[model samples]
Target: MKLFVYGTLLRGESNHHVLEGATLLFEGIKIQAKMYDTNIGYPAIELEEGSTIVGEVYEIQEYIWSSLDALEGYTGNPLTDMYSKEIVKVETNEGLIEVIVYTICDVSMKSVLIPSGNWIEYRSSLIR
Candidate 1:
């Protein structure tokens, strides 16, 4: 399976150690997607665009996806309310492919600030 990542799961991040070792089908490719700033010191996908926010797409085996799902707290339990998994098209080094995008629950994103819609630069500013 393939997935699109932008925030904490990005390369060189704490979670990237696990993700980088997996198969990556896209790198440095930008596409349209919405990235929102959450209070959790990270960002989440709020909405998707037809053609704005963009990131890389990666392909990994079931085991890697399982590990990622666990790390991302993607349980389908209605009470936990982590995120909903949806397939999104992303620009890849080779081309475009539909990859999983984790859009946070509406309630969880209600309190967010919804920055300029760029997760990477927003995060860089935060760290600086």
Candidate 2:
């Protein structure tokens, strides 16, 4: 299964260990979504129109789904989940493919908008 990761799960990020056995199929892929700084440690995204979000695509093992879901606070219940799993179209080198993405369920957590849409770039800028 293919997963679209935009925040901590991306390469060199804090929670990347969860994808240890996964293969990176694509990087810097842009999809229509609005990314925001949660004001905690990581970032969150909302599926929105007229916005682009930069993230990576990974081919993961079936067993990894459970771990990923848990880490993202997904319980298969939209009302209770912090993030809800959704299938969205992403443009890759090959073509547009549908991949699983976890979008923020609560908009209240979103504090700042990430204009660049690239979390890594936005994060690095904060350091320097």
Candidate 3:
């Protein structure tokens, strides 16, 4: 199973710790989706075409979904409520493939700057 993480799960981010034992494919790549800086807590993701944002891709065991889902607060609750976890097409140095994506939900704004789309770098910029 392949997973695409665009936010906190990106390498060097706080949440990447959850994927400690998984196989990492790459730590660079941008995905197209509407990104929002939700005033409530974290961020938000929407289905938007041609919207470029950076992230990472990984190949993991299918069984790892449950654990990953729990880390992302999925399964029991609702991914859409916290973050919309969807399968989207992403390009890695290898090629195009379907990978699981955890996108933000609810908030929408045209002015939110996604800052490189690389969550780690984006977070770094937020601090500076």
Candidate 3 lDDT, 1-128, residue by residue in tens: 77877766666666677777778887667677756655443445665777766667888776777777776556544535555578888787778888878765434422365644544555567789
What does candidate 2's lDDT look like per residue over 29-115, in tens digits? 988999999989889999988999999999999989999999999998888888998999888889999999999998787999999
Summed backbone clashes in each candidate are: 2, 0, 8
Write the residue-wise lDDT of candidate 1 on 1-65 in tens digits.
Answer: 78777777777666777685577666666556566676776677756565266565777777777
Off by over 4 Å in 1: 110-116
Model 3 residue 58 CA deviation in Å: 0.9
By TM-score: ranked, best first: 2, 1, 3
What lDDT score belongs to each candidate, Candidate 1 first?
A: 0.68, 0.93, 0.66
- The segments of candidate 3 whose C-alpha lies over 4 angstroms from its true place after superposition are 39-41, 76-80, 108-115
* Candidate 3: worst-modelled 10 consecutive residues by lDDT: 104-113
Query: Best candidate, TM-score-wise?
Result: 2
After the best TM-score superposition of candidate 1, give how far the Cα of residue 40 lies from its true spot, in angstroms: 1.5
